[model samples]
Target: MRTLLIKNAKNIITMDKDRNAYPGGSLYAVDQQIVAIGNDIPYQAADTVIDATGKIVYPGLINTHHHLYQNLTRNIPFVQKTELFDWLITLYDIWRCLRPEDIYLSAKVGLGELLKSGCTTAADHFYCFPNGVSGELIDEEIRAAGELGIRFFPTRGSMSLGRSKGGLPPDEVCQTEGAIMRDSRRLIETYHDPGRFAMVRVGVAPCSPFSITADLLRESASLARSYGVRMHTHLAETKDEDAYCLERLGMRPLEFMEANGWVGPDVWYAHGIYFDDGEIGRLAHRGCGVAHCPCSNMKMGSGVMPIVKMLQAGVSVGLGVDGSASNDGSNMLGEVRAAHLLHNLMHGTTDIGAEDCLRVATMRSAKVLGWADDIGSLEIGKAADLFMIDSRQLAFAGALHNDATLPVLAGLSQTVDTTIVSGKVVVKEGRLVGVDEEKLARMAQAASNRLLNEASLRTKIDYGRMRANRAYPNF
Candidate 1:
């Protein structure tokens, strides 16, 4: 079996039960499982040995929610100022033109960014399938993640309600319920690994309440439970969503979802910013989790999530960068920092600390993805998934007093010095291990340009022009 060893870390922040941290720590892994972790590890010889002299080791940050395909559609001038509903209508045309190559390249660019920023595991919600494209788009992204050596938990997301049926997406982009179920079954059967230390797992997601019918939500939840895989979707993200659900379904977002049996430990909602105190209690009672998207919420003006209250109420709260179009980037470390600062601003300084934000990004995020037993923290028998940053950098010169909180509290230098996933060094010296970063960026940008040009031609809108005040397209 292949072996890997890291020795003499400046500090190792283990997000374990007691929240133990070791100064001058050493970790040893046999193959993909961590075997020893402490201030002193006896055996040092291994196929790989890293002398992390001045580096702070952390449990690799987990991204509980993402739209990897949105990496190609970021910074659109027209939709930058729009809210969630208008943003969906404006971008549906562009997203419905996604090709398999675009998904592959976008995943590479996005996941590569996550890797350099210290995220080892990511869960992507890919829901937009272009009309008449029979290609396996989720498979393309899974391939990209495998090539990058990042642990992946991808949900087979489906949008079944169209504008003709009062949904946000155009009719052409929405799939039939039969088609969605068929593909969901196929993806889970083919890729869902129910074992511990799995590199890839599949989930079932029906995009959101406003984008899917009530019948589809129940069917999707039942199907996910039938396979024992997890369920994920966008829920309670915006006031617009709340308005839509209450107007159409005659109930609040959480109420409607719970009616469809969409609340449980195996289910997680993205951007749960609008849940009230009573709804938060119900969520905790049902053991449901929330993936908090701080940057995306602030950018979309959605509103701040009650993360401080959720944590206090025994809710499993985690961090997500959301879609790159919404967050405009896939930097997990940046997400953690933004979450810390945003919570401090909304709540008080004493409400949530920097280490608490890190915990949300690491351990709690893993729980959201249903991988808490295997890959959340640094411990014996857990997967060897972690990242290290050089705390001796000039950016962290005066801020290394508490290594557990240094990552969230430090400024500027967010890129990690090294990243190892599944006992394999996937990034070294703040760069991807086997990826041609320059080439990937060039190709991804070319893909983005092509999609935008096509979208502009199709819609007769100048997407390249600066139109900060322009009214967005109505689907």
Candidate 2:
């Protein structure tokens, strides 16, 4: 039985029931679970000791939504300024060129970025499968996460509606609904684990409303429930999606999802920007969760989510970095900062603050993913999943004026210096310990170029048509 001890931190934001902050506190872990947390614990010999005198410790950030594959296609020139539907349409051809190696390389690059930014738990929505790519794509991501030693929740995302069937994606990229369900079941049976300190888990994600059939949604939810895994999907991200569901399905997006068994405690939706008060109440009542992606929503002109309203109504909300292609970066710290700014902007200065944003990124995010009992907070008997930020940095030079209460405030004032997951140090001194960042960057760039140059995809992309087709299709 291995043990690790973290001693003499500047502060430890426990994020417990009382939201306590322990100054000059120490925590001890045996195996992968935290055994004790307080000012000073009785000495027991340990294999590892992290002296974090100048650092602040908190629960590792949890990312509730992301398209890790999209890291390969970030900041493409043509689609940089487009809205949600237009952006997806313009890049659909590019995403079709994603090979298994591309997925692996991008997952490494993206996960490395998240780890550097203090994110230890991440959920990746990898829906695109082209050229007969199997669930091996998800296996590659899981392999990367295991090598990095971070906790991962990879959703088996599927798209079953093509442009020929009035969907957003082309026929080559979309699969049959029956095949999607079968593969989803296969992925859950093979990957999902409910145990504490689990390294990898699976989620059922049926892409988005416009790219998948209603039948797929219902069936996927039923299958996920049968396997006791969680369900995720994109919902009401933009006004266009709102109009589409209202006109086509004779109900708003949330109402349509309810008709198809998509609402519950086990399901969470990404970029819930256009949900109304009634819909928010429905979500809160049913224990449904939302993965709030503030930067992506603002970048894509999807409007601000009523996050404050949702929280006030008792909805479970978490922070998401969304897709790197849309947000153009995978910095989880930046997502927390954006969440702070956007939520305050939407509700007013008094409603949402830095602590609220931090909670959304850590404990609240764990709740959204249904992993709160095991990994969200720094509690005895919980998994030792947390990160440290050096408060000595320039960002917090004058910010630690209130020494005892400073670390909680410094959460918004500094970047992560160390990221620990399951009692293992995955990042130390602000660098990834498990992989070479420079090499991963080079491989990611090469893969991005190859995706852009793929013949079948390059021939299908019509940049001129994308620019000319400005007519918003009637919902």
Candidate 3:
């Protein structure tokens, strides 16, 4: 069938078993799987040939967690300084006004941004569903990702505990457990492709411990396991969440999750910032994974995760941009850089280096999502999912000693020159190949404006012009 070749790369940072790097490298692929990769690749010509002479190539970054719809709700003035509980409380009112068009357009904007930043695979956690809105909102997201050509893993996220039932979300956004379970199964049967080099996969994600009931958590895990898919949720994200679990369930957040069968390699939690040393050890022992969202945690005033300790204890820790609302953007490269800098500040400069951050974004992230066999590295028979950066750019002028580290340690210019997914170049010359970005931006802005105005008018809460004057402004 179709074949692709990348030739004369400045350096190919292959995160293989040996963590090899080849200068003046080349890679060849047939159909979607890589056939050869090294300094001396055998057959030369292909249908598509990318001359990567001045560029450094690396395994495409994988995003383990995100809330793509929240791209429309970023930078709201009132919720800028709030912590997890208050932040979710304020945003739930606005998120309850989400429309199907909003979901599609925002997924385009968020997923498009991730593609530009060299993210080839993305796992999005879209959990909010207003009572009267379409229950199949994840379909819109799946459609958007297909159009963009980014390998998508969209979790059927649900929230069953409304404020009326002692949950964080408003009553309007919660749903019945029966409805959530039925939709999740339908999505898996319709779209989940477990075969190698899969372009689309599905996961079961209940919103969070505070936003969903324990019964739903157990049921969601059981449902996902029955279908042999992964499970995701937010856990141990803040001190307030710990307090809530201790008071409401008489257990810590991790302990409660364990009691509900939510711990294992097939499951991953977002923003694991509040786990103790003992809890981190438990996660390691149980083979659980953590999606560490450094940017979102910092933006929400959530404390830093004990990532260094987790890694030392052999826990699978991956980096994610979290949600567009909290991260303010889906820039996976920036997330990698932030992870490197933040950990160095917390631990030492040597504890988590630039290449280590890249590994976390690539290989470790794939492991977190249970996709290590098919993705996460540039190896023979693996999917040729990778990105290229022009290492000769002015920002990387003198930092060419280590091409693997250039992405994390170098100054700006993090936007990639090209991004390939499944042996197809989805982004070329720093632009999306399948999208007209200007049109997408216009439609997204219109959808976002309609959503915010509708929510504001319905609730009489001024989201656009609200002032952040007090130390803690009341929503």
Candidate 4:
């Protein structure tokens, strides 16, 4: 194993127990684990060293929720102005044309953008499996993550309910419960690694309460627990979801989830916007996590999630960019700025500051993904995953001394100068280490165009007409 030392950092914000920030900090690591960190850490000579002078380092940002496949369909004029149900209904027709190569290319673009913006780890929910798309699609995404060297939690997400079953998704996109469980077990047995600092871990996610049957939910939770993996799904994203639950299943969103054995620390939900006071309390009590997607919620016009109240009640809240189609981008730094500004506007106060946003993005996100013991904080014995920024940039001109707050308050979606994942510097000088980003862009654009053409022909919907109107600009 090779030992690497990072010395003379201008600032290292350790999001640890005491929330310490060290100036002129030095970090030492061997292989994948951090061995030491401080102003002056005494140790033997290393095989490699990175001089991080004039740079501010932090624990790499953790994104707890995403749909990497949706990166192929962002900014579609067809569904730009719709809410949750309408958006899903419209997009399901388009998403039914998914392909394996599309998943790989989309994962590269999404995870590549994430790494450039200082995100080291991310949890993706890949649920939509169209009719003709086959052959271990989740494995395709895992392969992409491996190539990119990003720590990944790729859940075997499923959708079972269809229009025939009184669900929003079309029948073509939904799956059989038997098939979902079979694949979930196979993925767990094949890919899951429960040890600390693992590169890839698997989870079983049954899309949502309205999309899947009651049996799948219980079985998924039980199966995930039996293997020590995690569970994830979308919940309480909007009032429409609440109404559907109350009308169809005769329970609130959280109540439906709890009834199906999905309330625990091992479980986390995406876009928890419409949860009530009691539900938040129960989530806190049960140690359940919430992956807050502020950008998507605002774009979909969903109500602001009560993040302050959730924190007050001790709920573990993390950051997520959500689906690329909804968020229209996959940059975690931009998500931080949106969370900081959006919450302030929603709360009408300075109660939740930039520090709080930064904390949730790093430390709390790690908790949400069940990695608090392994990653997140910059500490000894943790995974050596972090990012460094030259804070003397134009965006942070006047905020040099307050480097910690500038990430959220400055509102710049700038790329990091360097990002280190698992003791490897995967990004340097605001560019990927070995990736051909231009090739990825060209390939992704070609794949997206093919998908849109096929899907539009199948659905017979005229996005061109929608763009013709002033409501949507470019299709």
Candidate 5:
């Protein structure tokens, strides 16, 4: 087995159950698992040793929600200033033109950004498929993750309702409910590995409340249970979603999910900004998880999630950058920083601290993605997934002098110097190890242009019309 050693770190925030922070520590890894963690682990037997002096090491950030395909459409001027519904309507046509190359290029670009931001494990919810694409899209994403050496959970997301059926998505983008279920089963069987140090896993996601029928929700949950994977969906993301569920389904978004048997430890909801007090209690009691997307929520004008309340109520909550089109960036550090600032703004100054936000980004986020046992912390026998940030950078030049952990807490604006997933170094010196950055950026740009130029998408940009129609009888 190949052994690797990382020695002489300024500080290592384990984020383990003990919440240990080791000063001037070392870590040893044997083939994908951590063998030892403490001060001064010997490196004589290791094949490679990385000198991590003047750097901060932590459990790699976990991103629990993202539409990897959305990376290609970031910063589109027309949808930049729109709300969730209007933004979707404006971008749906563009998304409907996605091809296999678009999916691959976008996943590479997005996952590259995540790695640079110190994320090792990422969960992407890609629900849009057009032009007769099969599970090839998910396969491409998985391949990209494997190539980059990032631990990934790519949800088999599907949307079964179209505008013809009163759903938000256009008719061409929605699939038959049966096809969605079958593909979900196939994906799980092919890729859902429950073993430690799994490079790629699959989850069953039926898109969102407004875009899928109730029957599909119940069936998806049952199917996910059969395979023992996980379930995810969008819930209570906005007032419009709440109103839609209330008017059509005769219940709020959380109530509807509970009624449909979509609440449990093996499930998580994205956004969750509009949940009420009772809903929060329900989630806590049922052991549900939430992917808190502060940047996306702020960008799309979706209300702030009650993160402080959720954490206090025992709800498993983690950070997500969400879709790139909505967030306009895939920076996990920025997401944590936003979480820190937003929670403090929502609660008091002492309500949430930098460490707490960092916990959500690392350990809590891993728990939500069902990978806590193997990769969430720097512990013996756990997967060696972690990242290091150079404390000597301008962002942390003076911050590290006061406190060793202060740089991670306050230096959210910087990039990680090194990112390792499963004992393999995917990034060193703030660059990807497997792919060329310039080539990847150029391919992404070309793919984006090709998607945008599809003839079928030329007339799909009537944002005013969609916003005007947003008030149409709530369902």
Candidate 6:
């Protein structure tokens, strides 16, 4: 058996039932589980010891929504000004050109960034599975997450309706309902583990209401509930999306989703910016969760999610960095800070305080991912997944008194000093263990260049210089 001990931290921001914060904290664990907490934890022997002096400990952040493959497409100059629908249309072309190797490399690069930002578990919504691509692309992501030592919840995302069927994506990028359901079941059977501290859990996601048929939505929900797994998708993200749903489905986004049986504890929607008071109450009453992607929302001009209202109504709300293409990075700590600022501007106060943002990122996020019982808080009998930042640094000089809330409001965005996941130190001294960081960065950029080249993408402004020799496509 393996034993690990973390001793004498500056603070432990435990997002437990009591909302506890411990100073001069310590934690003890054996194998993958946390055995005890605090200075009085009984211990006889130890295989390893992590001296966390001058460091602030936190429950490993959980990212409830992401498009990990989009790490390769970050800041593609042209799409910077585009909004939700146009962004999807533009990226779908490039995404459909992806090979299995691209998926693997992008997932690794994205998950690596996330891990460095103190994210231990991430749920990647990968919906773009190009035709004739052999082997499970999601399997590539699973393999990459294992290599990087980050817990993963990769949804079998599907797009069934194409432009031909009044949807956002092209036909070639969409799949048949039968194929989507078949693969969703296979992935859940092959990878979804319902046990505590599960590293890999799969979900069934039919992309979104506008991207899939009503039949596919209802059936996907049934299939996921049948197998006891969660369901996820983007919903009501923007005014354009609201118009699309109302015009096409003859109902508001939430009504259409409710008609399709997409309410209840097992379902969580990404964005969720357009829901009203009645809808918010409905979500809270039904126990459905929301993955609030504030950075992506601001970047793409998507409306602000009513996180204050959601919390007031007792809805389960968590934070997500969204697709790296929209967010431009995978930093959960940054996401928390953005949430703090966004809500402050919207509601005009500290109604959504720093402690609240930390809870949203950790405790509520674990619940949103359906892993609440095991890995959210720093407590005994939980998974030993956490990150530490050296409070001795200048960033936390004055904010040290409010360590639990400081991470969200301190405006500090450096990588954590160390990160431990499942009783193993995956990141030590602010670097990933056993991984070549510089080499990975170079390789990822090379892969991105190859992908853009293969997709025939070029700068948008090159066409206006009377340069018909280079035809740049606008999406």
**What C-alpha lDDT values do all the predictions have?**
0.90, 0.85, 0.90, 0.89, 0.85, 0.87
Each model's TM-score?
Answer: 0.98, 0.94, 0.98, 0.97, 0.95, 0.95
- Show model 1 residue runs off by greater than 4 Å: 468-475
Better of 3 and 4 by lDDT: 3
* Model 6 C-alpha lDDT versus the unseen true structure: 0.87
Which pairs clash inside model 2?
none
State the lDDT of candidate 4 residue by residue for 285-337, as single tens digits: 99999999999989989889999999999999999999999998999989988
Alpha-carbon error at 114 in model 1, in Å?
0.6
**What digit string (tens of lDDT, one per residue) describes model 3 on residues 225-319?**
99899999999988888998999999998998999999998989998888988999999999999999999988878889988899999999998
The residue pairs that clash in candidate 6, if any, are none
Indicate the worst ten consecutive residues by lDDT in candidate 5: 463-472
Clashes of 1: 0
Off by over 4 Å in 4: 411-413, 468-475
After superposing candidate 2, which stretches have Cα over 4 Å from the reference?
A: 402-414, 455-457, 460-475
In candidate 3, stretches whose alpha carbon ends up further than 4 angstroms from where it belongs are 472-475
Compared with the true structure, what per-residue lDDT tens digits does model 6 show for residues 1-475?
7899888888888899898877887888988898888865676458989778988899999999999889888878656666788778877777877888889889998898888889999999999988888538999999999998999999989998999989999898899998888888889999999988899999988888778999999999899999999999998898988898889989998898899899999999999899999999999999999999999999988889989999999999988999999999999999998998888899977587878888899999999988988888989899999999987777777776678877776636674888889988998888889999998899888988777776664433321122222134453
TM-score of 1: 0.98
lDDT (tens digit, per residue) of candidate 1 on 89-143? 8899898788999999999999999998999999999999888987489999999
CA deviation > 4 Å runs, candidate 5: 401-413, 455-457, 460-475
Which rank order by lDDT, best down to worst? 1, 3, 4, 6, 5, 2
Model 1 vs truth, CA RMSD: 2.2
Q: Choose 2 or 3, whichever is better by lDDT.
A: 3
- Compose the digit string of candidate 5's lDDT tens values, residues 228-309: 8989998889999988888888888888888899999999999889988888998999999999999999988889999888
C-alpha RMSD (angstroms) for model 5: 3.6
Output the worst ten-in-a-row residue range by lDDT, candidate 2: 466-475
